[model samples]
Target: MTKKNKKDIFSSKNLNKNPSEKNTYNIDHVLDSVFGKEGTKKRELNRKKAMVLFRAEDLINERKESGLTQQEIADKLGKDKTYISKIENGKVTPSVDLFYRYVQAIGKRVEIV
Candidate 1:
């Protein structure tokens, strides 16, 4: 058997595209070509993350409004104050159940929209 040439290995035809043009690797272009531009992969991911951040911020504000110290809130949630701080600071993502417990500890109701 003979050794393959470097050019043969690096050629676009050997890979995934046409050798003649530039390919735009933007999320929109990729999704449009693969799944369709109407695909919600990017938007859905961002929206879900934004919602979690919004919920965390709301919980922090509510806790402040209720005049409860972080330690107090932590005690109510059966967690450490550091954990409460992490949630409030957006250092960690809380589960739906934990979010509800946080809101309740802050003397507020968790409303899902």
Candidate 2:
């Protein structure tokens, strides 16, 4: 084949036609391209969202471990159960003080790293 034909055959656009093609579009690569490098402005937003999700997951797990009902935790925190539910669902970011209180209430240690 001519060089131009070889290049076209190896291109990502043509990979779909060849099931055995080794070099194809990578989802991670595409995401990186769209979101920019980590710590960059675009990725910072993604990082914040991920942190909120992690916080929510941690809160739920801790509450379960402490055998606390949602209402109970809410009562201890002097907040509404719906507010706690929203935080656990990652619908909102809890204030630092509130987050610390949550950890304390669950008898868990909060490590800052």
Best candidate per TM-score, number? Answer: 2
Best by lDDT: 2
Each model's lDDT: 0.72, 0.80
Taking the tens digit of each residue's C-alpha lDDT, what string does model 1 give over 1-113? 12455455445554555446678223343334334346468556656677878867877788889999999988998999999989987779888899888888777885569
In candidate 2, which residue ranges exceed 4 Å CA deviation?
1-27, 33-40
lDDT of 2: 0.80
lDDT of 2 at 54: 90
Clashing pairs in 1: none
TM-score per prediction, in order, is: 0.53, 0.64
Rate residue 14 of model 2 by lDDT.
Answer: 47
Alpha-carbon shift of residue 95 in model 1 (angstroms): 3.9
- Taking the candidates one at a time, how many backbone clashes does each contain? 0, 0
The worst-scoring run of ten residues by lDDT in candidate 1 lies at: 24-33
